[model samples]
Target: MGRLPEAPLLLLVVTVSFLTGPDVHAGKILVFPVDGSHWVNMNLLIQNLHAKGHEVTVVRTATSWYVKEHAPHYRSITVTLPQAIVIEEEEFFVNFLMKMLEIKKEGVSPIGFMKFYWEMLNALSNIHQQASRLGVEILENRTLLQSIRDSRFDVVLLDPGLPVGVLVAHELKLPTVFNVRWITSGEGHFVVAPSPTSYVPTSGFAATDKMCFSERVKNMLFYFLNTCIDKLVVCPHYDRLVDKYFGPDVKFYHLLQGADIWLMRVDFVFEFPRPTMPNVAYIGGFQCKPSIPLSPELEEFVQSSGDHGFILMSLGTLVKGLPTEITSEIAAAFAQLPQKVIWRHTGERPGNLGNNTLLVKWMPQNDLLGHPKVKAFVAHGGTNGVYESIYHGVPVIGIPLLFDQFENVLRLEARGAARAVDATALTRQNFLEAVQDVLHNPSYRSNMRRLSALHRDQPLRPLDTAVYWIEFVMRHKGAAHLRTESYKMPWYSYYSVDVCCFLLAVLLILKAAVVGSVWFVCFRLCRRRKPKQE
Candidate 1:
């Protein structure tokens, strides 16, 4: 009577075990995100990790608005970077506009373009030096370093755009995962998968994956030039700084190669076919969210436009604000459209703004794109913005500014999902016409919708896939086995060029020996015949 039945006892044991299963293991993650849009993009992943109960500590140049708002949730270490090094948006925009104006006025010439290119490279070098200085400051802080060591983070996440992040990971003796917010570039060729210049378009260039003979030549030349600049100007400064901070034996390139995974913010649907290593994961649209409800005011404005629909305009965070002249031209173009306009502006209100236009400091871009009344996006063609537009199935009039924007827009145009107009060449009439074409034409919307469907049809959400891979690396203590053997080989050896050269040398030696033997045998036979004749 006192003993329980065997089946009942087994059931009780199983129930108790189910109720008290092992707790989800939380990992300590350290993230190094540089200032600007990269940090903004990184916040999506960081927030997700925090939600999953991971302890995350981010080292940033300055606390972003998001971090400031959510400061209590995670630890943020802010490094005070010099104002001179921190590129002021106003000054940068003024200089960029002046250069564009000069180029347009003087007309495009090979010499003029080369001069501008070098000037751009110099500017980039200055930024790289600033990043190095930031790294030095962090390394010099003994208290911070000691705290990091004590924390014993499972993995260090880095933005490889800033080489100092790689140095920090090296100093911590931790496995690294690079968070690249765009397609693979030549700068990280030594670390990530090999993106050959033959088909893989370089980051900033305006060539598609399929290029003509002349375009391929130009692409190769640009790739070569960028590599030279990185090695001669960029890497040396970073290498020296890393050597000074971390031991002399710690090379920046070696630390770069130590990365276990590359989380690239690109998708195959939008990108061309290319080889990717197992360690590289495509996490495009991780930041993209399902359309949330638009604010009442925004909804009212868009709905009031009726059948004509509306256009959404934004240049993203990097450009902070826009010039008055460009804004005025944009306003003028909007005035002509039957459709209403919603412009996200950080600058003063344009005097020529149409009665139908709504201007605000910030707008819910993805939501606006999802709205049925919205028709076409006039954007700066940033990769994030492009992905969002594609996600919502909206056509685009891309006003490419800098960096990968040009190439992103070029791909969109090739896919028939968008049209690109150089900012320098954007007139009120052309801008209006482009907007009208995208709206009136049916192909743009169709192509975008098709691509949007493809993008959304993934087996798992992009963010989940990303998180799984990240934790997978942590579980393995670094997925070193997943890294391609080519990552460890020199460039020449990776392509078998060295092996080819050795084979060629051996063939040449064998050919020379064979010829010598034939000549000697012929001479001996001739001499013997001559003696017999005598």
Candidate 2:
């Protein structure tokens, strides 16, 4: 009876200890995100952070197409811009897609290639210049700047594609974590990591790591163009802003390269083997989840497909519909297939709509992909969709358009899990042929299933990994130990050009000394012999 009383006392003590355990540390976070599809990825990350008890403040432009001014997850600091950037306009992208399709229809001609890239470069320049204006606006607002300073943010999380947050972080003297895939120059890896031209294919080039002589030459050319774009298109706008705000000598690219961590949205299962940096953490498919039961209407449709199954089609958040001509062709092709189709399209209906195809403004993409009835996916090769398809183990019929889509499709095609059709050259017959190949061939499904297994076999979910690293930065102040100091060195020093020159000079001096010694000895011998003769 005395021991029973002691046991109750011990239990109360344990409960008190559990209740008094340390709470999660809530860090102050500031965010500058690029609007539109990029926002989709950023929003999910913000939600996770908020759940972890972090206080997040997001900076949005007044003309933002996607980011709302008020959100339950984060506080907003909206800056007013003169106008939205070119990339923000939906109509501009639609028209741009049409132009690219026209250029791409001509196949692999130098003229056609140049035309396509030239248009891209011009559009890129305009977007960067306009984005710079946002940075300028933020810096000029003294009140806004003071509030950000007073908040004492732990880290500035940003998308470096536009890099408005980079500027703000520099001004505030805070560490940064980049949620990045693309940067101003090109792919984010090129900004800090070792990318050899012999194997590392440039973005938008449809070549894999294993390239022939001609493909290698083509890759080099694309790399050269990327360099020109960085210098001509990227540097001028950001450099001026950096100079104006941060002082005269601060290089914008160096500031860009000096981030604390990079949470790259790709993994080996989806990406080819390449050299990466310690600071870069691969978190591909972080946004994916197991399927939920669909709505009754959608469930009925899936059941109705019966033994034939159904194919899912979505061109991502952007590109709701292709041109009428292209859509009509696609619809005509779908008519011949026995498999039911659920296509996400907007605007006018295609002239040649098929009875087997169901058109909707939007569908639950992830849930639909996870469904057992999903036989195949027709996607425009966006990173999010590609990862989702990989997560679900669904084979793809790729209809690529715009930046990086071509390269993305090529990777899948090389792996034998997907078939790529030229969006510009797609006719009913060729498009139908590609679909039939993927549907009938068991290899595609098996390969994708293998990839899905590899992706899912990780010890921690990708999202958890990303969050751990981010909180790691918050805990330790910054991840300077993982970051390389190569960004601070000049190009000549970083490339070891100075070291190479010094070694060459030392060798030349040694060679000269040896020659001089030989010549002197021969002369002395000749003179001594002549003296003996005299």
Candidate 3:
């Protein structure tokens, strides 16, 4: 046959590939957000997946009072446990451990140490057992599993903070991906596989990796011991259930180790010093939907603020317990500013009020940020709030308190998008200066706008990318190639230097054995000759 023109041949191949591409027949995906704000970006993904003609179902758990306060109107299937059950269980164990550490620090006798070990292990085991039992009860009785089966879901997308959802994904023999919204020391950051580099220090806390060798060893030992306790007390129950539902040989870590992909709420540009993993993708600021309308009150708050726009102060949901000193410093800063300030103060304010400052129990954060009258965000750098500020191209003064907040703020500072002022170091003077810098300075706003462009410049919206990958997992049965090699490599192998040393030791042992045998044989022959002469 005569050769076709290059353009026609290329077109024919492209047409065929497009028609037979892997994503054409994506399977049904069930997405369950453990908490509601997690639902914000997740819902967008679910909506996009449905729009893309893929089968997607979202199973949600409803508000605890916490969720109600922060994420009202979020869709979920509500269920109630006894009040404070999880918190009580968690606190008791936390206190017990704290006490144990105190006693150890005081220096226990050998006998006392042994006794303490036993008591601590037993208590920890019991706590895990209780949590596991509760997990089992919920999974079996809650109709969550049944709903997944009814939907005939081929895969489950889950948030690991909701352990039950992780457990259900295991039971169903479904490929799973994690949508991580925050940083967890235990699980590492969502988009990046666990790395020592991802460990960032909180303001009052010491650096995670800067510990002395002995301290690192001790922490590693504690982690190891804790994992053993969890494996002993908790994992068996879930693993057994998974085996019963799926197959005899399937394991819980297989699901954890097999996490197909992670759609992290982190943008690489914003989180410097981040570790990368192929199975993980950075899609931070995914939660910030564009140009959403603002409520009238927020609009009015913006409009009433004269020529200079207002500043936004929100400490986020977790740290409602703002220290009086911090609050006073903030109030002092507001008093000097020409701008109006909106503060999301959770509790009753002491009689101190500046005329320019407005204290609200809650203000619509996204709405306020979107407003043109908002000049800067004075924030705690919670991932959601930080991302939102960047999304709106507003300058920030980050007063980070905990978790990855310090690191997030540090990255923003490095980007010139924000400044990280230590909450503890905040004096009334410094606070005012920082606020003025963010507001009056063009550099901070210019930096923020640059990042905002980079954050928004994805070929696909974060939601679409997230949804495409969820469907990708369904289409490829987990795209096992996309899985990181780190998952397969043992710790020894991952640090190749250690592996090489180990191999050298083994070779030395073999060499020593051969040398010793030859020497012994020669000595024996020499001894035999001497004896005969005698």
Candidate 4:
């Protein structure tokens, strides 16, 4: 063959290098992930990271319901516990959901609200007490501890909701990255940023950013409740462990806030505009992608509905099914609709289930949402599902369960992209009205499409953005420059209470000196007045 020209020769070399060359970089990552729906998104990141030449190893509990023992994308290390956290049991969560639904039946009054949070406190306390044991178990195991130390893992990625990962990462002396939305304290921002309760509504408050005075009061009360949960229900579990291994001087929330990068699972598009930190990177909808072709059978089912499009419904990963009564009401409501329904549910079949509805133990929720024929989404307002609904421009009829789900749907409702139905007050009639309104409503779809456009009009894909930050931490060893030392400050210091007090004292002294000078000058100038009075 003739020798190529210089330009062509260079191009050929570049092409060859691109085709059969070494990866741009390969880094070792250690992950301590929360299971269930959280793991679903985490697994997506792991797959993408693996594709980009990173090696991932996950630390999971032996009793994990979703984090598999074997997977191609990552290796797993299972920690044995005396008992799987009581809250991890399927039965416990189902029963908890059922009871919460019952409590909510009285509606949004103070008595009903108190009953809900009281039950939440009980479950939240138990989950944290059990979850905090994972770090201790790892530390107690000499072999595991030594092995982890020897691995020289580049970074630790975790969900701070459970927060055991933060403790373990701190002990390992590795840079930490949080795949965060909720922290044990509440919303991740409350732990890591300057959140003003004046406008930034606390999770589950279901209030929007623009609030009246009374709404702000409720927001503060909700915030105070979250802080109490942290101090009373969540912190004590991790505090002793911090004292034992890390030292008493180390604050637990400080460890959480100190993560090198916070890959927040929400964007301003979905979340109300709030204060954020340099270390926090919003990567909402990172798990979303363009839909792929549906299976033949599924496609036929989807196409069966004529001009009236279908609605996809799912309660999320942990909720396999609702109580029979709720399901029956929902099913009856669906039966009244003209649109066909695909519900991802498993359990006793609803007696009133309509011919127009299809129930499955599982469904491709994301792909189905992206389908052109999907008219609306009936969901429990999970973060993942909500984001997918936005990404695909599908309006939502939200059935919020607990823990930020309410807030998620409330945001969509605020945007005119969704509607929320109180599960406690759920009835066939009410549910049917909400669904029909969403279906017929042109505003909902247009609003969601606009959100989808805004969400998509970014310089970088959210997933790639997340991967870049994760790799950014790995390359630098730590992102200390981006992290805030504010987490280490006392509350008074953090809020500048001391500075305010000092300034106030100086102002008072200046005023007092001026008053004294004026009095003295007046006495000197008007001395004859005092003599005349005598």
Best by TM-score: 2
Query: lDDT tens string, model 3, 1-534?
Result: 998999999999989988876535645776655443454556666656666676665543232323332232233444444333332232453355345435634677889888877886665445334434444655667476576567677787776544456666766767888887542224334224554522432222324445666656555665565456557755665577667656866655555667788887778657645456777766787768665666787667677887988998897765443556557777876888888888988754734468988888877788789877889999887788989999899989998765457667766887888887876667788988888877788999999999888888888877767877877787777767878656556567777878799889999999999999999999999999997899
Error of 4 at 180 (Å): 0.6
Worst 10 residues of 1 by lDDT: 182-191
**For candidate 4, lDDT tens digit of each residue in 1-534?**
987799989998989988994335699999988877888889999999999989899998989988899999899889998768764577776877877777656457787788777877887787888898898899889999999989889999998878898888988899999998888877888888888989899866989999999999999998888788789888998988999987868888778778899999998899889888899999999999999999998899989998888999999978768888889999999998888999998889987999999998889988999999999999999999999999999999999996779889999999999999988788999999998898888999999999999999999999999999998888888899998798787889988999999999999999999999999999897996888889
Pairs in clash, predicted candidate 1: none
Q: Show where candidate 2 strays beyond 4 Å.
A: 1-24, 106-120, 531-534
Q: How close to the true structure is residue 308 of candidate 1, measured as C-alpha lDDT?
A: 91
- Give the count of colliding residue pairs in each prediction: 0, 0, 1, 0
CA lDDT scores, all candidates in order: 0.79, 0.89, 0.67, 0.89
Better of 1 and 3 by TM-score: 1
lDDT of each residue in 1-534, candidate 2, tens digit only: 446688899999988977985433789999999887899999999999999899999988788888899999999998887878877778877888877777666556787788777887788888988899988887898987898899999999999989878888899988899998999878899897999989999976889899999999999998998888789887799999999888988888888999999999988887888899999999999998899999999989988999999999999887757888988999999998888999999968998998999999989999999999999999999999999999999999999888898888888888889999888888999999999999999999999999899999999999988888888888888999999998899889999999999999999999999999999999999989997899
The C-alpha stretches of model 4 lying farther than 4 A from their native spots are 1-24, 106-119, 521-534
The number of the candidate with the highest lDDT is 2
lDDT of 3 at 117: 72
Q: What is the lDDT of residue 79 in candidate 3?
A: 42
